[model samples]
Target chain A: MAYTIELFMVSVGVGLISGALINISIGYKFHNKGGLIGGLIVGLLMAIL
Target chain B: MIEVFGLNLLGLIGLILFFGVLIASLRGWIPQDILPVQSALMLTAFILIILAFILGKPIGLKDIQMNIYLHPITALIAGFLVAGALEAAGAFKAAINILEKLSKTTLGLPGTVVILVNIPTIFAMPCGRILAAALIPAAILFGYILAREHKQPALASIVVFGFIVNAAASCGPSPLGGIGMVGEGMAGGLGVAGVQLGSFVNAQQIAIMMITAVTMLSMSLVFKITPDELLIASEEKAEEKREKKEGVSREGYISFFFFFIGIAIVFITQPPIPIQTILIFFVVVIMLVAKISVKDLIGGVILHPIMAMISGFIIAGALVAIGSFDVMIQILNVLAQTPLGYIGVAVLIANIPTILPMPCGRIIAMALMPGILLFGLRMTEIGLPEIATPILLTAFIVNAAASCGPSPLGGIGGIGEGNLGTAIGSSGRPQQVGIMIGTGIAAVIISFFGFI
Candidate 1:
């Protein structure tokens, strides 16, 4: 498959979201909401950009 | 010549802070509890936001919300989860058992080590650590068996070294895993202005050939594992005992089938829909058939290296926003204009991860790839051969990805050290450095031959 710019951006977006959710879940599991917030902030930034 | 040190004031600040964060992350200078990926992302975001504020640029949640529309991240996550689900479903164990039996029929412990070490190349899972966690014990067991048979305890070390080389270097050929996908994603990013990223399969094939050859040869010549030792077999009764333990499970078979089905769908259809969604759909089906729990699915498959990748993306985005890549390209561009500058830069890029070892190749790739790609593009734009870009960039990608295995801090090398009861930096360093330099030199040579 051709590697298009559109595809690259989509991958970046998905990576950010999935990564945020995963970290947030881990943080919650451990009662480390600070980490959760940290993850959420990064995720939010990616979403915004 | 806009400002200080060839950077505008904002660019200078970004460059300083970016390297500062990178160095701190690499050196474990951050808070004890915070993950390196986490620190890198948050700090980068904070730096960029502050810089944007100073420059009077509006940054808001509305901008972040747009990240949800992107499709490729889902595909990347799906690839990881598919491997994760299969791993959770006991498919790897079954495969290991089958491999163990097959190894018995080959020469002996050396053959078993070969099979166990190289298994990841064929399986191509996203979770290299998890896969290593599972397989290292099996390797150790075989190593002990070899040591006992040969009456030399050092044989076990040889086996461990061999396993590290094969397993760590196997990341290149995996089309669906974090290593392969991240490399492809970086290549795709470089696909701007009519450059084709080429087939993921082709990259995988080249990675496999180069890594396997370099690693195996090093195992033999450097590690002193002779061909005769590899060809010898364990005692017949011991072989039978291993054979008797091999039994197929219906769940394992089904999980295996689904894993391949996911891969086949990816290869055959090349579906535009986020591949992760498709793979996860298959994973859900496997979970239903195999009776896997929702908790297990989320806990095991979703949380790990996937999160690491997210943090990496955020950090990468922040770097780009702050003009880090532009500065990097300017410096590298100057370097590229010199004699043999491309080779020098390729060597430096290949070794950076080893010097500042991270747990995942994706993190390093995400951080450095833009600069690397821009360097390649600039070289081509400057009248170098078109092949120069991919060959040089591929070399950088392969080395960066493969070097993570030998990282002294909690990567495959750490796992190997843990199993061998050796100190953290002592045992796996040679093999780690060997593979890093070996694969790197191999790529450079291949690229020189225009094979990349």
Candidate 2:
């Protein structure tokens, strides 16, 4: 349980840092575009599954 | 403790404002530095209570003690510590390095890198968007590195992997991720019956993942596009940053090792609040260890998450006010009593959420039991008032799946656009959006029959 807690936190932190970098580098337009595609695919998969 | 129709209304209102801002910003109408949903919601709730105190709306300044704000604050602190600590530990770096290394090998290079990196995440997390939030930077960095090497196909492959596998898998679960989260919620608290995630590792989840992966991988090869090489010469760049290495205590390695340990521990342990909390905890610790400030640490929580919450509020309000959720549920209830209505029931159930709105896409996963029941009952003509459970379950599936798709009304599309790259404003947007919709729709249909 402790281990899982640790991993989830780290993954989240890494995610945040990475997110910051993305914001600085490519700008939000690209980020939003990528997010939209990911969202659609994830949603579709979630629906039928 | 204050709740509104299964969600905290305080949070819901805040979430709506955030989502509205995100939509406005993405449309190029607003500035980028608006208050994040977390801050916005918390602030809104606080301000509202303050106003309420003046107006005597039940919550006074004294009515709100430190404990009142404790829940979200605890979540934030805990979330930050978990994320930072593990990132400082180094799991993230090693994993990225290993994946990159595998892609460099003669036999394994490029072709298998995405598949190798993506599988575990698909079954492990509840939200693909959340996974995307985690993986996109890694992919982009990989792409950046590859761009430096003039390895366009490699970079493309990495980016595609981030978008497809890590992002797409958040929708459905067999024994992994957020779908699993809602699956448990429905099976346990609601006590209605449907496919038990553990018992049902069907073809749906696998098939969608595979197809998307194949599509992205193939697109890379076909386009022969490498973002084609670096604009900056590699040698001159090396000299610029090499000097700064002495001052910092190398938090990256700590982040790399500890973070991997964190993920490994989570996979092995599978604790409460999901393993993601652990991942974020390590990230926070790494930042602290590395000397990043509380403000910077808070900044890492992402503005989009706040916006996503805001979007959730708008959606929940609109759905309830306009009777969208109810209307859809009624439609499903009508279809659940036929003999072979599973196909229609399945398709409809999967599609509605695409139309509805939400903060977290995983909310869609709760639909499995109801959708399945609707299909089964629709076929058998079970129209008793007691048959409502099956009816609700059907809607849940569609809502869950659609919420994650390319909906303009703030579904997973909103989350994706909020956090990842899309074809939003550029010429590529049409193609990107097309791919998103085409693939998503196909995946939805396939999942109906368990086509993994």
Report the number of the highest-lDDT candidate: 1
lDDT of 2 by residue, B320-407 (tens): 3322344444555556457635455654544444433333443323212333443444434554333333333423432353244443
- Per-prediction TM-score: 0.74, 0.50
TM-score of chain B of each: 0.81, 0.53
- lDDT tens digits by residue: candidate 1, A1-49: 4444433343333333332322222112222333233223322222221
Label model 1 with its docking quality class.
incorrect
Please give the fraction of native interface contacts (Cα pairs under 8 Å between A and B) kept by each candidate.
Answer: 0.02, 0.00
RMSD of 1: 13.3
Would you list the C-alpha lDDT of every candidate in the order shown?
A: 0.55, 0.39
Model 1, residue B226: distance off in Å is 18
lDDT for B174 in candidate 2 is 27
User: Per-candidate DockQ versus the true complex?
Assistant: 0.02, 0.04
